[model samples]
Target chain A: MKIKTDKIKKISKSSFTIYGMVIMAYVIMQILVSTGSLSSLMEGLLVPLCIYVILAVSLNLTVGILGELSLGHAGFMCVGAFTGAFFSVATVDLITIPLLRFGIAIILGALAAAVFGIILGIPVLRLRGDYLAIVTLAFGEIIKNFVNVIYIGTDKNGFHFSMKDAVALKLEEGGKVIINGAQGITGTPNDSTFTIGIILIIIILFVILNLVNSRAGRAIMAIRDNRIAAESIGINITKYKLMAFTISASMAGVAGVLYAHNLSTLTALPKNFGYNMSIMILVFVVLGGIGNVGGSIIAAVLLTLLPELLRGLNDYRMLIYAIVLIVMMIFNSSPKAIELREKYSLKRLFTKKTKGEDA
Target chain B: MALLDVKNLGISFGGLRAVDSFHIEVEKGQLYGLIGPNGAGKTTVFNMLTGVYQPGDGKITLDGNDITGKRTIDINRAGIARTFQNIRLFKELTVMDNVKVGLHEHYKYSTIAGILRLPSYYKKEKEMNEKALELLKVFDLDKEKDFLASNLPYGKQRKLEIARALATNPKLLLLDEPAAGMNPNETKELMDTIRFVRDEFDMTILLIEHDMKLVAGICEKLTVLNFGQVLAEGNTAEVLKNPQVITAYLGE
Candidate 1:
């Protein structure tokens, strides 16, 4: 469906033009995939790339849009990932076709994440921004730990099957639950194709794009910019904050499920959904400029790829990466980067003007 | 019946009583002003009335309904919308979006509509845009609808705040210093705009202003608050001349 032009036009003209460029980039990606020259590592990176893009953009919904720091995003991700994996692993043989199993698993995973998101969102949402962030972060840890303690050995019939028996039963036979615990669930059907991941990313991007442009989304942003003002003007700060938090979590859950199944593992390691993951997502939002959805997606892709590109640094890899992060943080806080960006953009604008005159 | 009836409302912070035994009533469609010198508890009165603070002892009734201790959103939903004393516009959002935020109370589409991109959502959304544009146009701000609220000039920002509150479709609008930082010319324009909004919205307004001239010019009735108590309450002319009000303003 065509986006309402009025809202689209309301964004800066440069941003509106950039939207076209993004679409073209997506099209070129599709062409590259069909041509099949993209390397295996690049192809492998695509799913995580899409997943992180969604996580970063969605997390920004709460952190950036509602002006609340939500560190508990990974917790919601854990919930959704496990829930989806639980379903797909439990019902793998129930659906004969691999394609159908993949489709259902992803959808179920997203829905599972959304459900848990609402559950987690309601309680801590009443807190102020800093408190909300901390509470959410704790929650992610809780979810991660909770999964480890959960008993996943019993089948739907309540029969506790041994790991060997469960494996022999075949995924199609409605056998035992697959998430084995800290050891990790193996033999997870890898249905997360680049096509599916990209499609999901596009859907998330469009949804967030529409939402931030919509009236409700603006209300959330309003609450973010000046909560007291938003409240005074009859906008309920808590309600909008909760909406953003839950929505962000739900999308993160979607990403988490993609990640779990794509990797064909279901280990509920606390480290997997730990504080570092949350910070990584936050860095994506902050580096991109908090409220800019397109920028968030771009940052997510770049950050996800950065470490991989830095792999050649060998022993100095993490040290150099740490230096880069410190530099980014230093530049970020003081508006120097913003000033430079503006100056650069001005030059581009003037060049475009000169080009127009020449034409 | 009074549109808003606040009786004996008070709030205490530790041993200090911020608002004590304050009472006021506004008849439907009347423009009432609450004014006092600095630290006169005018804002505290507004705060208690709007459910920002639960009164230690008091009752607030709106249109014969008890709204005492209700949450701010509940109060808003029950037809009381207010602006803050500190100008709190959503700084980063555009001017049109700011007004649209006010219209959020009227947005009926569910999250399902949002996720699915339903036609009903689009229809409702389009209607909201038209209404937001109309509201902005009323205040002569439609041209700058895309500009961030913080980017607007001080007077325009004040106007935007009022526009946003108006979007909530409140029966009783509380404006906490609508003319706080305005120059004489801007304040005059604000006075006219306030009057226009009151008449156009068919709303009862209870505004807190320190400017006596504005209180006298725009408010049909005035309540003079001193030390969390109503020092005087009557029609504007009478209250402005009251000895207690003069002392509260002049500080004997």
Candidate 2:
């Protein structure tokens, strides 16, 4: 019984550490902005940092927890961005308030992405590791390109859709083209603030960490460790797998909504919502150490910030990024590095302090 | 009526007759053993019983309910739980969490309840934690409850597997080679544990074992199979004394 409490306490403490880290960073960034120390370029990146953090954490759920590599997360984000942007654009006049409208848009975006996740997971999850990864990669690219051909317009006839150019919709006067195919949706309200992004990160952390410690989480992890044993123990393999996948995709969708609301224009480009974006999120998960949520959070922040910080070194920007990735890989995973890290970890210091109190 | 009854149970891997017309009956609280030489298809029978493999022929009834060829999860829910010969513990999960996973169906809470952490989540989780601890205690593993299953020594891993199996609250427990890798001391302790589990849980057990002493000591009844056919089925001592069984074990 005492051991159980210690375990629970340990879980909560680690979670608090993560929360503390985020809040501390927020305060420091705010201080920098107020003192005019941070550049205008760095300030622009505040919201994007939140989006990448979210993407990395959600992808960790699929790759680390569910033990399935999903490279099409960007596709779900693409779906969310377009759908949320469309909702906001279409209903701009109907809903005058930004908060209520963006809230509903986030929900709409998340639901759309979850639907796609279910559709993809139902078939693709049947395949194991490499095949699933390849299929998801293809799906990510397909979603990006698929959005490029779509055209939607709002008129008296109530939303015209066309696979061709925006002109094919043949809109009447005063009708608005909300989605201009590859040009994408523009005039989306910039509802995202750094504060809101931080709050969302807290919520995601709560949902994910809570889920991981619960009975459902244990069942999911069991399936990951040994599928046959989990089945024999009566865990519904498909249900848990689909649950984790859909939840992850939904979180990615929320991140997408956040991203769309932060931008004046939302586009499903190869660089933004394509396979490259998917791989970037995956690198955050992998380099952060799979299943280590806090590590991924830090990885997302550092990796996102590094490119900007190294912007002064134009010729060697990506080179520095690559070197950092390799170094982080070694530092996070190598046995000797782990030993050194633990030997000097803040956790150890805290433990010693507590032990002294106990003494 | 038997706790578990199988008649003419068979499965074929394409053209190969893996287990041909197998038969066994385990009464309530009986310690039944299935023994055979390597390649005698012992594990195949276990697979069929646990719904890992659909039987090519015959019926499987547990507590008089037909559970033939159900999915593995369904069969477990229907009161049959099993452990693997190779010790398929959830290696990454803590010992307590591993057992808690087996108690999954018995504990009632939705994914939403878990995520939002409603009052019921605390209530159920506390109860599960206590119950899982009680199970680990039964295996003398309560101390290592927080350790990952992979970090456990070999013998404890085997015991943890059984503890996980029993956590399902199954009426019958199937152990595939529970003593496969145990030393003599560990094997003796395991024998005591199997007997204690049978008595304490009122469990009907069917185990596959290569350890002759373990089989002869704990098993009240024995079924010997050779080349997918049941060579003999009777009292443990009588089966061990049979010349054909000896021949099957040692060969001419």
TM-score of chain A of each: 0.82, 0.92
- Which regions of candidate 1 fall more than 4 Å away from where they truly are? A1-5, A9-37, A149-151, A154-177, A314-322, A333-359
Error of 1 at B132 (Å): 1.7
Q: Write model 1 residue lDDT over B91-160, tens digit each, in one string.
A: 7777877888888879778766765668877787788888999999999999888676766888888888
Weakest ten-residue segment in model 1 chain A by summed lDDT: A350-359
What RMSD, rounded to one decimal, does every model reach?
A: 4.7, 3.2
Predicted model with the maximum DockQ? 2
Model 2 ranges off by over 4 Å: A1-4, A312-335, A338-359
Q: Estimate, for each residue in A201-227, the C-alpha lDDT of model 2 and write its tens digit.
A: 999989999999898999999999999
lDDT of 2 by residue, B9-83 (tens): 998888999899899999999999999999999999999999989999999999989999899999999999999
Candidate 1, residue B187: Cα displacement in angstroms equals: 1.5
> Could you give me the TM-score of model 1 versus the true structure?
0.88
